[model samples]
Structures are given as structure tokens and as C-alpha cells.
Target: MAELKEIVSTLDAELDIKSFGKDSSFSRFIPRVYEPLKFDWQTAFEKDFVELFNGLMLKGNSTVGKVFLAVFPTDKVLERFIEESNSGDLLFMHHPLLMECGDPKGKWGQGFVPIKEKYIKQMKEKNLSVYTCHIPLDCHKQLGTNIAMAKKLNAQILVDDTLNAKNEYVLYCNIEKTNTANLISVLENIFEIPYVDFEGKKLEDIQRIAIVAGCGDVVDWMKEAEENGVQAYITGEIHCHIDNDYGKQKYNQIMEYASNTSMSLIGVSHSASEYLVHKTLMKDLFEKNFNVETVLIPQEKWWL
Candidate 1:
């Protein structure tokens, strides 16, 4: 068994949680009927895991016998965790709130909805702990979401923070000579997804690639990748397809850029892209350091 405090401290320092800025995506868009906590997001994140609202969201028990890692605290996933786990188990996720990152094949998501009050009560009653890490995990060198994808693909890193100070979160890699079709096949297998949203020219020769794990429709990132001689760009969502003016504008810009640019855009899905970190590296970290059995609660439907 590992003490919850110890795990939090070790992870906080190792991941350098405080280095990254502005993870407060939840501050503005909280659920209309949010269960008013004794302490709000600002107060809750005062001491440790202080990326506004990133770490140790709830304290159920002092020590944890097992750890459940998830990409998001979706209602279904949380229900499963509560059912399967002991009172003292921990739920370590990438996000505390349920981020509705629209289904690739279906409609757009509701976006950053807070957990229901009943679920919060159930967790408190069951003595289940909740911990969240967002940006830090995304940008970490060895265990980051992007690096995990690069490692799984076996791509040689051409430009990153370790080798070049220029690139941090997004990785520019050199893959062994392969075409877009073969690379897509490899990615589908790696992330265990049915389809990947791909844009741009499907060429036969793809030497260099850019990888951004989640919500990778940023036109600037693609522009930079093009400038750096990247042939393909891999991300979770090439087009968020959100049902809003901003979303439409962003989508159109990304489509335009991808249409014009030579680099291919591949979206693996937001949840699956980030899930790799927890499944492999993050799982290893908990098992190795805490010596506790870790349960990875995956999103039921990657498309959703």
C-alpha cells in the first residue's frame, strides 16, 4: 500500500506540475448545478498540485491499496471505478471534469461538465480519492502523451526539448521510410481505433512527422510543422467539429491550412491519444514506485 500523500508529493515533483501555466479550463464552464464544495477550485488547489485545479481534487483516505488511472472522470468510468475499487483506491486522471471532446463520427460534446453531486457524495462515502494532472503530463519528456505516441510508433525524435530547446509539447520526429497508408495502419493498431481523421496529401514517402496528442487542430502548430519540413502531423482531433461559431471558424482555418499544406493531418481521437500515457508509462510509474496494482479505466467509446 502507498500513502496518498506520498504518491501526490512524488508525482507533483517528478512531473513538475507547477511549471506549466493555466490549466483552469474548468473555472468558467462549471456545471450550472455544481455541488458547492466547502472549498472552491482556487482554495482546493492552494498548496500541492497548484496548477489552479490540477492535483488531489478529493481526499478519501490517507493510503491507497490500488490506483485506477483514467483519461477522464466520465460518469461511466467513475461508476465502474466505484464498483470495482476498494474504499481507499485512487482515481488518477488527466482531467477532473468530464470534457466532452465531441465524437468523431457523431455530434459535438457538451464540454467541461462537472461531476454530478450524487457522484461526489458517493465517492466521499466510499472513501475513494481523486487526483488530476493535465498540462504537466502532456509536456513531460519521457512520459508525455506525445512522447508516448512517438515511442510506440518507434519514430526517431528529430526535434524536442531534450535535443533542441525549440519544441516542447509537440514532437517533430523522423520515421523510417513509409507512406501515409502504412503509417495510418500502424497508428490505428497502436491506439486501437477504427478510423483516423486524415487530411492533406496522402503521399508515398513520409520521412519526418509532427505529433500532438490531443485537440491538434491548431493552425499555427501545423504551420510550424510545415516550416520545419514535417511530412505528417499526428494528433487526437484534426477537426473538433464543435457546434459553435468559434469551433466552425477554427475548423475552417484548420481545413484550409491542411488543404494548402503538404503535411498530412491524422487525428487519433482525444481520449485514446492521452490514454496511452496512463496505459504504459503512468501505469509503470505507479506499479514501480507504489508497488500497487493499477487499473486503467479506458473510455468506453473512443469516438464519443
Candidate 2:
């Protein structure tokens, strides 16, 4: 247990949470829409504000035998993990527990999802601890999702000047002149995704790139890329839900912006883009720094 706390402390120190600021402003609006579901947003902010959604969600035992890492804690994944884990095992994930929050109409809201109560009960029964590191992991300079992805593409990572509302850094890279098709092929191979979505000019016109791994669908990031002279932008998801009117509008706007600006866009599955942070960066960090046994379980691709 002492070692586990030490490990968490070390991670907190290494990430420098104090410098990142405490306000969980992103999640603040969630409670207003629906009662804070699985985890209390306000309490989390009040207790450990410096770390942005980074802490032990469920306190288990004092000692941990092994650590299991994943991008999200889906019910099946969590159940399987708990079944295979011993009493003192720990589950470290990027996203938090999925919670079902509804609006006045009783329909599910945009950000909230259904909570898996059975999974939580199972974890408690098995005495398993659940730890999550969302923005902090994404903001880490050396092992962040964007940096890891940039390194895998073999692009010359220039600097981390791009900033998001959460104060996270987006990586800018200069890749040897590569066409859009070839770049898409490379990304597909790297992420093991079958297909990718591209928007904007001809495939051959892509050169300089900007990378923001998981949720790069933000318009501000796109504008920043354009302002920084980025010829191509790569991101996880592109918000193309045909059934959703708002999503369709956002998608069309992004496509139009890319076309008008002559900038290219490539998007892959969100899980695939961020999985490398667990499989490569966290694995290496834990094994090298703490000499701990770590197992990385990739989130199953839900695209079928």
C-alpha cells in the first residue's frame, strides 16, 4: 500500500499538477444538467484541485500486487479485469466511470453515459482500486498521448505552444513532405485502424502537421492550426454522427473550414489514438521508474 501511494505521489509530482491549476471547469456544468452521477464533480475539485480528474476513484487495499491500464473502463473490460485480478490488484485508466446523467426530458445528455453499477459492485467485492488520469495524462510532456503519437509518426516535434481550455499542450510537428493518402496509410498502420476520414485539399498537398490525440474535434484547435501555418491536422474523432443534427453541422463546418483554408484533416478512432499512451508511455514509465508489473489492455474497437 505504501509503495502504491508512493507511485501515485511520484506521478503527481512528475506531472506537476500544481502548475496546471485546480478548477474542474469542464465538469462544473455537468452537475447542473443532472446530479453528479458516479463521482462527485464538486468534491473532486475541492479535495484535490491541482490534479485534473487524476486520483484514485475507489480506495481498495493498502498494497497492490499488479496494475492494469486501459483507456476506458467499459463494463466487460472491468468485469474481465476484476475476474482475472487478485485481491490487491489496481486498475488505472484514462477516462472515468461512465455515468448516466439525464436532462429534464429524461433523455441522456451529450457528455453523460450509462453507468455500469454491476461493474462497480464487482470491483468492490473483489477489493480492486480504480484510478483515473484524464487531462493530466494528456498534458504530460514526455509521455502524453499527442507526444507519443507524434514520435510514432517519426515527425520532428517542434514545440508545445498550443494550449487548450484545460491548459494542455498540443504538439506541432514537421514531417518530411508526405501526401495525404500516404499519411493516412501510415496512420492506419500505426493505430491498427481499418480506415481513416480525410477532409480538405488534394492528398499530395499535405506537409506540416499538428497533432492533438483524443478529442481534437475542437474548432479552437483547428483555428490554432491554421494560425500556426499547419498544412495538415490529425485528430482522434471528427464528430460525424449522421443521426445527430448538431454533430452533422459541426462536421460540415469542420470540412468547410478545412476546404476553405486549404488545410487537410485526418481522423481515426479515439481509443486507438490514445491507447499507445498506456501501451507504450505508461508501460515504459512504470517499468523503468517503479519496476512494477504493469499490464496494458487496449480498449476494444467498437466500430465493428
- What does each candidate score in C-alpha RMSD? 2.9, 5.2
Question: In lDDT terms, which candidate is top?
Answer: 1
Tens-place lDDT per residue, model 2, 176-273, is 89888788889889988777766666557666888888767777777877777787888876544333566557767776676576677777766677
lDDT of 1: 0.81
For candidate 2, the per-residue lDDT at 242 reads: 33
Backbone clashes, each candidate: 0, 3
Candidate 1 per-residue C-alpha lDDT over 1-304 given as tens digits, one digit per residue, 9 for 90 to 100: 9898899899878888766655745444442325454335444333444444567787878879999999977889989999998987999998877777777678887656677667777988998888888877888888899988988988898744443325466788898999999999999999999998888989899999889998788888788888788889999999877777777788789878876889878999999999999999999999989868999898998876
TM-scores for the candidates: 0.91, 0.82
Q: How high is the lDDT of residue 20 in model 1?
A: 61
Model 2, C-alpha of 192: deviation from truth (Å): 1.0
lDDT (Cα atoms) of all candidates against the true structure: 0.81, 0.67
